[model samples]
Target: MNELPSRAHRPVRVLRVLASRHADSTRMVRPQDFDTELVAQAASVSDVDGHERYVPLCVDWRDARLLLSRWDDDCAMSDVPFLYQRQRRTATHLLAVPFEQLDAPGRAARMTPTFIFSIGRCGSTLLSRLLAAVGEQSVSEPDVLTSVAHFDDDAERAAAQGARERIVQSCVAAFEPACGPAPVIKLRARCNRAIDVFLNAMPHARYVFMCRDRDDWVRSSSRAFGDSGEALAELLKASVEAFDRMHAARVDPVLVWYEDLLADPVRALRRILLARDDLDARRAAVERALRTDAQEGSGLSRASLAMRTGDAGALAAFGARWREIRPERLLREHGLSRLR
Candidate 1:
């Protein structure tokens, strides 16, 4: 039972909640509560984000449901429910799983050993798409690469295990022959660091390092994630450490630099084709990506010949930028940079 109040307050939605009755987990509250609350509210309201939210009697206990909101012009029973239909929310939280149970026991045979591991904010996504044109494979975002690979707590570990299994399922969907040509996985560089089981099973799998100019990367990063210098620095530092692992493993991977690709995308991609795959389909896809990516990355570089010529202001906007971290120098030093 829920109803809006006339307290001259900012707009907020109310949800009913309940804790799981089973006592396998000690924590009364769960992140799943947040997930369910959001889902249920979304069920009730059309513009959930625009409106502020509130839940009455939202204490640690049981019973929660989503309901539409209504305001009172002026009345005593404003917050009271029209019809009381409250019941408990979902009972199981993936967080309840133990750390030791994080890994999935499965016989996932290798179909491919190659992975496109981006050093955060690099053209990992673009490269992944380009690679998709080359081979039949599945693509994903920072997801498994971000939270799962670096699970700090038991809940995250459990989540990671589930995410890993889902990724495998994604691979199966991409190519019908599950273990035929092998599936190339694309993820952030740190994923390589945490995937012990994957590395052990697929030894031939090589990691492709996707790079971007430190400054341009920072610029793009700022647009995506604002004013978090400490977080950026920490992420960059972690990325460097992860790439370092690739070097220590003695894996001479395919390195695609951001600057080099932007400068002459076709030539750079042809070079990539020299080692990775010599098939015409792969080569053609790289060429197509070159044209498309050029349109997408038009003004990324200040020095690029193709900087927004007609719109002088856009070109000027990209002028004289530099990165706080000199990843190019570090790349060369760490042997993660490109070779002939």
Candidate 2:
């Protein structure tokens, strides 16, 4: 097995050093202030001619900066199971742009993008891959949006609301030149907390909500993460509440259940497609996508997750615990009686 790095050389410590330097100075970072080799690998935003190849990987909210990684092609981005993993593996040089300086012209007027929100373990990744296979520019789980979702400080988050919204808009716009006319973005499961920010940023965007049955979701989550039954129940509770808010919102989202999606994926695709003019042409692509594992090379792949021993007793306990914390009435109110 590969040995872990020493504590002093860990990523968290390195980030802390950078953050300390950033916090102390208002001026732009200089090569001498940090590791020369690392600085040499950083790119200036102005040096890049086009935005299409640069993807927003994450946000350093403390310093109010967004990190963009350069991707060589769409294949480099889409082939990976998740955008963050692609960044970790292939991003040799990065561009850090201040939130105030980031801009995408005509962003407000551009055709609204499509969003895929889910409670996870619910075929969202499969849907994303299927869309990509069909020639759609499907972006799966970009970290920047997740950062915004888990900003953590209420006062700071409230103060930076406008900047946060702009960052969200700019990040979406950055993908347009290559992924347009409408890029479909699949958000991380926890990202639903900031769903309002996305909705407010792009009022006209289409939304698709994906979810699975409560018992299956809890079981899958527990098995995938090896977490306790209680922990999984809490996550389920939070996720369902977020879904409830979105479902009751002014924008009507296309609701897809995992069972129904697996039953008839083409039907689900048809519902999500803005126009069915090319549905017939994309049918084979969808079938091909279904044949393959969407999370194949990622840590979350089925083969990788299968290495963990399943605990039947734990799953049974989760089912009993879920009943105690059940949102059955909430599901019924949102027309999710099927989930109940």
Candidate of highest lDDT: 2
Each model's Cα RMSD: 16.7, 9.1
TM-score of each: 0.49, 0.81
How far is 22's C-alpha from truth in model 1 (Å)?
28
- For candidate 1, the TM-score is 0.49
Model 1, range 118-184, lDDT digits (tens) per residue?
A: 6555666555555555553533331322333554467545434423433333322223232244445
Q: State the local distance difference test value for candidate 1.
A: 0.41
Full-model lDDT for every candidate: 0.41, 0.68
Candidate with maximal TM-score: 2
Instruction: State how far residue 20 of model 1 sits from its true place (Å).
Output: 20
